[model samples]
Target: MILQGNDPTTGASFTLGNRLQRQLWQCVWLCLFRPSPRPLHAWRAALLRLFGARLGPHVHIYPGVKIWAPWQLSVGGHSGVADGVTLYNMAPIEIGAYCVVSQGAHLCTGSHDYNSANFQLVAHPIVLASHVWICAEAFVSPGVSLAEGAVVAPRSVVTRSLRTPWTVYAGIPARPISTRTRHGTAPD
Candidate 1:
């Protein structure tokens, strides 16, 4: 769950970049990405790039996916975000080439500081290196970076950065379950 700074329930407590920019984006998203079909990945990527996202070649963004701020999202070439993915990128969320973000996954770059009385908004960047796969329904916490070739099992919750690449992780607060090996020049 996220404690959004721009939450209507919280009133105007945090900044969502510029008001004019956000308004413009809302219009574009509503008319373009939101209503577009799932196969229109190229169109979605182009729209996101036009809004300041550093999208690489062949980045596939599904129509059902929701990106809070396109400018704060970056995806490398051949990386695909499956349907039902949510990018709550209050900060930056960078994904390297050849990575796949599965359906129902949430890449959240923002969180609330529970210790604070105001539940102050805290943000951190999320980086997913090349050949990484975050399985369905996984929750990637703020500031967590997944190294190259890492596999986050379905429904896993990653709360910390995993420096070791080519490993399989599972369970809540995901931990390394085993080392993954690639098969014949492709990812494991």
Candidate 2:
């Protein structure tokens, strides 16, 4: 939740409970989640589920991935979040079925309002529709939603929502480069 009147620069942006939970999660992540073998996707998924994350069957979340809050994350069936991906979900982040988030991709749901004198904390949810693919090193900004079958090219930055399904986006501020042809089996 965005702290409407709180000054992020001087005061705490999140509740005490929230801060404690994150600290505990960090310990677990360092000890249990980070050192696991790469093939142990199910093990990591179980750890995430234990923290209240809603993950569907066969979702492969690599051990190297960093999730700010697992409880605020949800991944649909057969989706894969590759190694080095950072899910900074201050708010909820939802990844639809059959999606792929490649290595080094960052999905951020929190930011500070630059215009505010106190640097107010702000947050919004990020949504990746079914069959969406975020290529390696892509940066998805807060509140951005990618349509079904939308693909973000490697190293691209997405500041706005990608409304066109089956489209491929590229460049710094990602723009539609080509319309992709969708072909994929339904997640069981």
CA lDDT, candidate 1, residue 127? 98
List the global CA lDDT of all models: 0.87, 0.93
TM-scores for the candidates: 0.89, 0.96
Give lDDT tens digits, candidate 2, residues 20-91: 899999999999999999999999999999999999989999999999999999999999999999999999
State which candidate has the highest TM-score: 2
TM-score (C-alpha) between model 2 and the true structure: 0.96
Clashes of 2: 0
Alpha-carbon deviation at 143 in model 1, angstroms: 0.6
Candidate 1, superposed: residue stretches over 4 Å from native: 1-11, 184-188
Clashing pairs in 1: none
lDDT of 1 by residue, 103-170 (tens): 99999998778877667778899999999999999999999999999999999999999999889999
